[model samples]
Target: MFTGLSAFPLTPVTDHGIDEESFAGLVQRLAAARVDSITALGSTGSYPYLDRAERARAARLAVEHAAATPVIVGIGALRTRDVLELAQDAQDAGASGVLLAPVSYQALTADEVFGLYADVTAELSVPLVVYDNPGTTHFTFTDDLYTRIAELPNVASVKIPGVPADPGAAAERVSALRALLPASVTIGVSGDPLAATGLNAGCHAWYSVVAGTLPEPALAITRAASTGDATAATAESERLQPLWELFARHGSLRVVSAIAETLGLLGHPNLTRPLRGLPDHDRAAVTHVVQQLELH
Candidate 1:
């Protein structure tokens, strides 16, 4: 459940609220592609913007539509009590695991971060993936903190943000982090553009954003890497370099929303208020890239 490719699907919503049908379609698409797992309400899902009920609904929809694939729900919230509630909601929804990042408004000390994990993990019955997404959480975990939190019960995997760009450096970094963590806790790499590099360097899994909307290309890379054909994995990822460049320019959330919209998998104004999809010109660029790359 924690390893290989865990696709993070966007939670498409409308003025009326959760778009249950579209969300289910997204989950089902990933499941049909046989992604290693489905993660609902991750940062890509715009989780922080959704209320408890909405997030709970999204979790349930993901689990229900994901077929036999494992589902991991993101249970991150600003408050510890809320995080616990979300965790319980995910568990009740039958999530195979839960992904948690230490969400906060104020700056949190390392001790506070560690305490957050301790408090939440104590209440969690299912396995927990330590989400180290500094991009959204604004809380960085030191090696010492990772060591401490990973020592707690139910710590199944560590979702590291990304690895170094240079292959040697990436390998050494993952190797050193691997030594710090318990063998039971797998290391999954995020940052879609660097996924191939990280996996070739030693990451056990890829927590991908694009995979949610387009699973075929993602599966190609993951299968290649997992099967020990690192060259094929790198080539496949490089083949999608245009998409990665767009993700760098417009932010993955907006770029992916555009892709889903372009592909007609989601409706207009699908995102919550104040967070619109890409502009017309940018979307035109996306269409050109999608066609040029022949992305389905």
Candidate 2:
């Protein structure tokens, strides 16, 4: 299971195809920074936007350049068979583990979600991380459902999104989850803005979006929180409040892509069409935040 900061890099695309050079550079940068792990084909990576071939290529490239760093590939698909195939491809590509989310067009029942993970887990060689992002999946997991999934074979961790507005409530929720889940299963939190609160709440890891470009600060926050240094962690989190505000206003995908482009971390910040980059105003806002933070 992945612990600490798992940086999810954006999938830098070009007019032709995946920008291999830029993608590899990003992976190398994360590896150099010594992020706990790297997740390719994540939401930030725009996994759903790309075809299977593109996703497979991205997985291979991530694993290849990740060096000693463990790589976790997102194998989320609407269909069970597609998810299974992607999981197998991730294993073949030398990925350390796979992240699976219950994604569906029609609303999914708890039983269906359980069956999806049960079937996928039975076939996978590596461990699976259960992704619980209701915002996108539209399928929320009750505590009972999470307990059932945690009992599944090879399910190592659960990635829960934090409630940024209510850190106290989020901490209590984390405590409840910790009590419900087995000791072996790690609990990680996503949604970068909520990370400090989540980490302070005793989350084992932070699945961060900003860490994809500016890992130093992200790691600093996580490290402080993980070590029980509330003062330091809160200070670091406050320091990045400007960038987090941008993430809250404009979506993280747009703002982070713009920040990466502005920082020259990626060759092009172009997202797969239909999903566009930040507009001029938002781009200016992100640029100002990045410069103010001296992120570049």
Candidate 3:
């Protein structure tokens, strides 16, 4: 079972290319922190911005540094063939699994989405994680579609983004999905803000962004929630409310990049060009939250 926290680190970038040293350092840190798994080339990794070669290199580097820790590499692409090739590359790179989100230039139909996974599953030998992050992909997965995808040969887990507006509703949704999925299909929640609620509602794992930079706090919430301690989980969530507000105001990519820079996790928190880091004011806000939480 793919349970517990899966840390998705920001892909550190330098003028020349991927900051390989810094990237390895981040992965090694997460491994030392004992995160259940690590995901490279994920949304935060800026996978879409990189070319095929860059993505492949990032996957290999992550797998190498991850050592004993399992690494799940994001293989999402707009085209079916591209996704298939990336999955094969990930498997060859020694990744434990591959995560796929139905990212499309045009909105995809249900059958088209199903076909995409089916084709990839046919090619991939590693476990497949269905990433239902409609916020970024603009491709929502219906329960029927989820069930269909989960039935695929190598589909082992689904990363469900939380419904942030109403955590109660999100918890209920998690419970419903839990009942709907097969016993072998692990239900993990992304959307850092909703992780505690999702776990309390019985999610087996947390696909976390904040954990990439601050594993301790993220782990605290997940551990408490996983053990059925709703009070402790809620408390930790409340403590992170300020940071969550920033994430809501700005996207996590911006806030998390800023936090990473503030903590000196990267040489600089430079994301791929065209996607800049947070402005001065927002960055100050992140710094304040990090200090208040004593995350640094």
Candidate achieving the largest TM-score? 1
> TM-score of model 1 relative to the true fold?
0.99
Clashes of each: 0, 0, 0
User: In the order shown, what is each candidate's alpha-carbon RMSD?
Assistant: 0.7, 1.1, 1.3
CA lDDT scores, all candidates in order: 0.93, 0.89, 0.89
Candidate 3 residue-wise lDDT, 102-200, digit = tens: 998899999999999999998888898999999899998899999988999999999988754466787788778878889999999899987888888
Q: Give the higher-lDDT candidate: 2 or 3.
A: 2
Candidate 1 residue pairs that clash: none
- Would you estimate the TM-scores of all the predictions? 0.99, 0.97, 0.97
lDDT of 1 at 16: 94
**lDDT preference between candidates 1 and 2, better one:** 1
Clashing pairs in 2: none
Rank candidates, lDDT, best first: 1, 2, 3
After TM-score superposition, the amount by which residue 283's alpha carbon in candidate 1 deviates from its true location, in angstroms, is: 0.8
- Poorest lDDT segment (10 consecutive residues) of candidate 1: 268-277
How many pairs in model 1 have backbone atoms within 3 A of each other, for residues 3 or more apart or on separate chains, i.e. clashes?
Answer: 0
As a TM-score, model 2 comes out at 0.97
